[model samples]
Target: MMRRRLLYWITALGLGTLILASTGYAQTLSQQVLNLLARTNTWTADQTFDNLTITGVCTGCGGAGGGTVTSVAMTVAPAAIFDIGGTPIVGAGTLALSLDTQANNLAFMGPNGGGPSVPA
Candidate 1:
């Protein structure tokens, strides 16, 4: 329910901004969209992990562990607003994504695992 509500709000906010821009209140709709994207700090998302391997590394300690077949959580942040040459590009926004965690979100894992304890 919470996830649904959050998604609804995000969609509503985006759509509302687009509508405002489209109605010629200020800037172009496309530019407004770009500005919105460029202004967001970070957005996170959850995803399934199927046949994917994650690697862990410890510098100086020379310890590493990695495996395959698990779950994945992802977070993305806005990249540098300016270009490599220190020039601010017009209407350019990009996201830098990082896979935060790996585990399973299946029915067998119970409610904590992301699924119901029993089949619904």
Candidate 2:
């Protein structure tokens, strides 16, 4: 009886762990934005995302002397709302924006443009 009970407990524990491990959890919109902002490397490929809510202001993303250029090519889904700087706006198709802090300039790039205005 003791051995049978121990086997049953072990089986139950194994099954529970398996179930938990197999379950997938999706990241929240806030988490996704946080992850994107945390990225330090340049993205070579394009990325697609659903609705994005960008809150708060970036104090010093351009580093010291403001000579940093960050390039991103991302497509927001159709009918998705983008909340930037507390302003909510609905956009269709791709939305690309490049920020060049070295020159203190920002540009909105459309499709078929000569890449971003920022120096590579």
Candidate 3:
């Protein structure tokens, strides 16, 4: 009986470890998006700057008398938002932004080899 109990405990521990180990391979949607962005460099960071001025300080940059100060304002594009557990639903090779795995179990509802359509 003692040996059987030990075997049961070992089996339980092994199963628990296996379950936890399997989860490590599965990445969250946000993590996947971040990894993709880092690799692809497709998105640009958002930035805002105002009243920026530069003055010469180097020996060859010339003295303050010869330097000029300029004011400028700039804005950069914002990054894309990655919704949690978000998955794309494509139909006829077109993405249906309005459809998701949660809302629609089957994302592809059109006939196979059908013509392309505009993505949502």
Measured over all alpha carbons after superposition, the RMSD of each candidate to the real structure, in angstroms, is 27.3, 25.9, 28.9
- The per-model lDDT (C-alpha) reads 0.31, 0.31, 0.28
Compared with the true structure, the alpha-carbon lDDT of candidate 1 equals 0.31
For candidate 1, write residues 8-93 as lDDT tens digits: 11111222122222233322245444434545433222211232111211112324786653333323343332223213333454
Error of 3 at 30 (Å): 71
How many pairs of residues collide in each model?
Answer: 1, 0, 0
lDDT of 3 by residue, 18-105 (tens): 1112223322234334335335333223211232111211112223576543433222322122122222322323222332234435
- Provide the lDDT at 92 for model 3: 25
- Estimate TM-scores for all models: 0.12, 0.12, 0.12
Model 2 alpha-carbon miss at residue 12, Å: 33
Measured by TM-score, how close is model 2 to the native structure?
0.12
Spell out the clash pairs found in candidate 3.
none
Per-residue lDDT over 37-109 for candidate 2, one digit per residue giving the tens place of the 0 to 100 score: 4352332222223432222322223455755334434444331233223123344234444432333364546
**Candidate 3: which stretches are off by over 4 Å?**
1-65, 79-120
TM-score: which candidate is best?
Answer: 1
